[model samples]
Target: MSTLTTPHRPSGAAPHRPYRPSGLTWTVLRLHRTALYVWGAALLAAVAALIWLLAAGPDARAIVGGCDASEPFPIDCGTAHWTTTARIHASGLALVSACVTFQIYAVAVWAGAALTGRELESGTARLAWTQSVTPARWLATRLAVPAVLLTAGTTLAVLLLNWTRRAGRGDLSGGWFTMNVFISSGPVAVGYALAGLALGALAGLVLRRALPAAAAALAAAYVLHEVLDGFRMSLWPAETVTGRAALQLPHGTLVLEHGAVTGAGERLSNNMACVGTDSAAALERCVERTGLTDFWTTYQPESHFWPLQLVESGLLLAVTGLAAAAAFALLRRQHS
Candidate 1:
């Protein structure tokens, strides 16, 4: 009877469950809670701004529309109303898109300084390595977690941005080819952010110092951005149109190379004779004098937006993979 008896518990007492911590994911999240919060707040702010702009768009457009019929909305159009509401809408769109496009810089800097570099520099990573976690697992968790969060946040922001863009189509300052709009409007923004993360991690591994690693990461990201932007137009095949028809190409055409085409089929860009030809009659004289059979123009239409985006994103993701692989290899070599 004594062996079969069980001890009585207090009325409020509950059965104990194991106090297991949430493991590496929780650890990483806790370690970088400030950055996580900042990122979330930033995205929320961008979305909120865009939503406001979307709602106020019609009113803004109407105010501007009531102005004089100037081709470009004059600085004094509708005086205070146009200057206040319309410019505010334009500025909001510009600001949000610019922030979204350039967020990769912040991502790279944070990833390098706080995410990986600081931990390694302070020997926290070494301590983790000595514990149950391996360096590979630690690095994987760092990259993968940030990447997932970055992708989800950026993708949502971009989708909302696209919707807002549609709502304020005519009010936009520039077309789809504009740097901020182009970069922030598609999946390429996610690729850039992930690339920033990978590049930052690699920089941290290579430098092992927070400040220098952050600088290196920023420099690397800038170089990547500039290079990709320079080559973006060349990623997909552009349509080549010849003759007078090329001069009247549609509104959104991204004119890459426009000049005179020689009878021998040579493409001459900015032929010396046509350098300052202001009038259509003068341009015709220049083309005829330059032995040019037709005015040839190579350009990308609005339709090529997706193809260019995919190509650029593919290249960026390729960079991400290479950087991540290099970081892992460097870690193995140093630790082994």
Candidate 2:
């Protein structure tokens, strides 16, 4: 009786909001939550490792004297250099470095196998399409969710890595030019992750089979990684230091090429015969005979680090945009 007289509501009254994803978007998220969980766990672990390294870094430096000496001769600083603390810190760094290096491949594989390929192969995507979600929307949802998650996670990881590397400083961290250090310590890491996601989605859509898609994604990601790594140093013009007297490069300079130059400023390749000289006097004779007026060194000083990082990251993000565009176009054509 009371229900029969149900209370009147205003025409413009707002409906009760439920906490859940709706439609195909919800379906996509629900299906991929496991992968999301794994990603979160891995990120948390990396953060923990970085924090541990930060705390233990000083002890590691103390054991190894921070390797700060600028002597011309190598010092045999002994077994203390390899103390347990140092080893642990090194291991932590290695683990973090590995995560940054391999994250692209991992993203590609997961995107191919779990996000797109598996859904298409299993007919779930088709089923969703039948239920009012257009193919374009389906694909967009697939890419968007992962893109948001990958961006956040990768950005956080990179910032944490930069902090950790700064914390360790001195000899405990890799040089700025080192591949892993360079990639992990800046925005390029996020770009790589997004590119991997886009490429993997494309691979999955093209292959439509989980295993093959995963393999293709991995191969594509590796090729991209290699290409970027090779091109990194060339992203910015290097500065050259020329001196008639032997000079020590400023610390932390990323030397690109160092060899003899003529007074006319012509660059010369390294002469093997000259390089083979073991004695300083022999080297001097070789330099004199070669018409070398000065030793010229081309290098990227530490100041170039940010410029290089920004350039590389911009290129990678462009690649990501292309891959995403291609995937969307392909999906639209298939549906049309």
Candidate 3:
């Protein structure tokens, strides 16, 4: 044979790298490709709807606006096309809003069940550790990848939502503090998503089972959110507008409490239902019957929107940090 001996490699030549199923980041992406696809599809759908709304928004506004000022309202406009357009836009907004609102729970379930628990249950995570990847590194990669994706996706969705809301600003009737509007319109959405991911990962590390971990994570997230929602109003001080008579709060004011005030300054919130009665006599009787003198209203102005959102976002991010720290600590303990 001309060369029976093995070919000699150069002294300084690099050795061929061993094959792996995939790199860490690529593995995470590949494993959760279904979720990625779903996320992408949602974004695409929202973008498409928003683009259509932007195009149709002006025409819809004009059609509704063109109505005789004396007419009843949109119903009196009598254009089927206008009705259809408005309905479509409203439905689009509802769909997108629901997605944003539910993202926290969705992310929690996925992180708990698919991202961590399933791998642990099947011994895949142990396998990864034996393949020259440290436990911390693997866990870090898992959380980091999803965190980046969540942030990017949520940010985009919020921007798109803000744009769409602005497009329909003339017709959209709600204060900024409204739950759906508040969550979908600001950076707090990102905070909620990340918190969900961290809490889910913690749940996964603890449970090490798919269904149970997912359920636990979801319940935990819901409880935390409910608690947070309860404290939202207290995050910032409300502006009080008091007057000797019924006060006309500025448009877009988020009235926390409005009621007639007695001479002793006691706020009687339960007594205001009759103030706006169709019958003038009934309104007078209600006001006089209550012996109310001054009126006071506590509210959040439009300017308070960002302050409230930022505070709530900060609290959520703080929770995320704690959850992530717990998960890493738990993993470290187990690895040791």
Candidate 4:
């Protein structure tokens, strides 16, 4: 047998990474089991319950009977609804609750905040990170699963909400559901996970102890998540002059300073309509102030879904990127 001598490969650049799945992912999945179950299972549970309610509940028309003809705002039922105002709002609220404003996003960010910050404190995460896996990659892959699952969960939850909302669209009160729910891989969701992940990764890489980090991450993320995500927009109420008793816009953040109103008969410079829910809200504040044709009483308050999601998510992602980079940099410098 002639042994052919193969030429040694010259080193110029690293070879392309093979398409095989990284076994590191298994470690991530293993590390993230509790967090996933807590967030994912809870979300799935909520969705399943929603599905059941939607499937089992009375049809919208049956509940509605002939309420479209009433005063305030009426749809095409055209017969002048005889129902009381309370019943109108009650019936309309089913659709309202399905909105991102009302339920899905509310549940998701809160749920994610809960999931991300608690891992290290429990002494659970370090079991994997101490191995060949770098702490940054470990944290990233761990967070990636839940973020993905929750994003899909939000999308599906919103879809189901849409399905329920569609059933009642013949009624104007039901139109709130017709508006899209803006939960995507958007900044808010990413920010939420990042909030947790950053805090946790910081704890893991810096503190080297999971429990303290987990507890602190969860507590801090919990306290700050909404404030940060909404950028204090949701924290304060934006007074309207009662042209209509419009619910505050989700994308249109209102800040309230008690006993402050403008001389021009406007609510206040900061408290009223400073941020309207427009598609352009995604751009920097220098881009636009007022929203599009979205803030009218003819529609529900949360018609601008995407902008809110984008703003919150954008802030989160920005912070997350910075945080991950910082963690990676810190870990690289560690003596261990």
Candidate 5:
């Protein structure tokens, strides 16, 4: 009675804290921390390279005579042009494009092999379900964590790519509609990433074996990529420029179709005979004989860049949603 006694706590009992519901999310993140680190490092590298390219842009343009000057000039100009061109082709634009493309494929493989398939194959997914986590919540956590990280990484890369491309655009060799350029330069990068994630998850759930799932996911991703590439130009209605004389397409225009058109607007195959000759009179005669009233060129202008990007992005996002929904539905069916 005379001594003050401290309350004894149970050895097995831990300190009480406010309820926090991020355990599953935290677990997913911790398990994949290595991947996160690699992704972060790659992203940082890409960003640094992009910034360097941006900074070097003015010099590159000056070397190339500011995008408007004729080629084959002074020795210094030639050296500068060659150096800039080599750098861009080898490490600048090409590097960024490869990085983004690799990310999409890597995400698909990881999602299938490490994220969902392995867990299910090892029976840990079942064990987690026993620990009061529903299959839905478990799968949600799995997909959501990677999805968030992928979106952020992809978005940053895309923004950096856009900056780099815009800065060095005048000196760059490719058009905006170039497949690699288009994919890396806009929100479609993020969309592709998301689609990869969803496709991978679906592959994982379906196969439940890491290696097979990874392969399946990779194949699905490639098919999606090819489909998107084929349909991209059709996303927006192209503008047509027609002239009685051979019309000169603007620099950087993405020509979808170019052929001879009669005055009544009948499109015909291009007259190859008129090509590769310096004589304008021969071209004129060819056009006259072909009854070509005008040379019509269907093209996506530089101005249509945003519209095409948005449309492709939207379609990709929609595909992501469908794949995600399918995965969830399959999970529910299997678990229930």
Candidate 6:
């Protein structure tokens, strides 16, 4: 009975190997560890900022107002909105920038490097292709693990931001809000980060190398960010991200473009209206004298909340999702 139970196995039978990562996976894990500190720091800053904003009163803006531009780092975020280049810092405000940058340099860049990039670089991918795991699974596991965890971290950051901003406002205004484009600011970041990873891999597919792939992907994504602010700016008629009918200004109305201008009662400029002089008073006096050809309204950040948040987030997410889908398909089809 014992003999029957313990039938001799052929030498070719699978060996009783102890648990061990495939050499490729080990390389991936080793590389990913470098990103931990980056991810940790971004999340930590977000949490701390949220805590500070809640504890500190609204007047805390006063302290940060005077901060000089030695480098936006260690920026006192309390008065960040009041500063001139306010929007520039918004990306960094809720831990979004730190996490996004970390993801870009680490996960996004390294994934491209390790997946097809490293293999193609060392001339080892051909060797790896002949191993036990198929190239697709190899790529999938390596990309998926860190990506899933990263997405979670990003989502948390977004939530913290939303909480803090609401606390700062002391109430939730429900119209078109700018800050809400990122509900937590962190989610879109994570979304973009993942999109970056997928893009890096796709770049690997396209270039069949790592360094170039990573660089191409990161550069492409960044340039898109730069262009995005101006994306529908000239293209879309008015307020591509938000909509509430351009308010009627005193002389004309503030069009999306060309603020406080000479002749625009009928013509609506997009974001600006250029009046002859600086002062709203001076502009009004000119309008009274000239019999009001165009209206001139200055920029007013939306005071309304929920409506604005919904629209901006929706449009951004839609655009991001489309970009991501394309990147995902590109990654999936790399070996296909």
User: How many clashes (backbone N, Cα, C below 3 Å) per candidate?
Assistant: 0, 0, 0, 13, 0, 36
Two-way lDDT contest, 4 vs 5, winner: 5
Model 2, stretches more than 4 Å misplaced?
Answer: 1-23, 59-82, 244-246, 261-267, 271-292
Candidate 3: tens digits of C-alpha lDDT, residues 240-334: 87653245666777777877777687768845544445565665676687677767777788899899999999999999999999999999999
**Model 4 CA lDDT for position 293:** 23
Candidate 2 per-residue lDDT over residues 1-336, each given as its tens digit: 354575777899987788866776677778998998898899899888787677767676564455535545335443445565556666677678768877999999999887889989999999988988888888998999888888888788888777777776534556888888888888888889999999999999999999999999999999999998998899999987665322356778876777776768876755223533556677678777877766766788999999999999999999999999999998888888
lDDT of each: 0.86, 0.81, 0.82, 0.47, 0.81, 0.53
Tens-place lDDT per residue, model 6, 1-336, is: 354476678988996779977575566666555566666775687677656655654445444564555756645643464543333234335245344434544555655666557666776755666777666666666667667777787777667655655655422322222333423343445655665666666666677777787787677666654554344223323332211122333332223444323444454444333343556666567657755455433332333223434443455456546654564566567557
Cα misplacement distance, residue 130 of candidate 3 (Å): 0.8
Structural RMSD, model 6: 9.4
lDDT of 1 at 297: 74
Q: Give the lowest summed-lDDT range of ten residues in model 1.
A: 270-279
Candidate 5: lDDT of 68?
28
RMSD of each: 5.5, 6.1, 4.9, 13.6, 5.3, 9.4
Q: List runs of model 1 lying over 4 Å from the truth.
A: 1-21, 61-83, 261-268, 271-293
Give me the candidate number with maximum lDDT. Answer: 1
**TM-score of each predicted structure versus truth:** 0.83, 0.81, 0.84, 0.50, 0.82, 0.57
The TM-score of candidate 4 is 0.50
For residues 207-292, write the lDDT of model 1, one tens digit per residue: 99899999999999999999998888899999997667666778788888778768898877854345445578977887777787
Candidates arranged by TM-score, highest first: 3, 1, 5, 2, 6, 4
In the predicted model 2, the residue pairs found to clash are: none
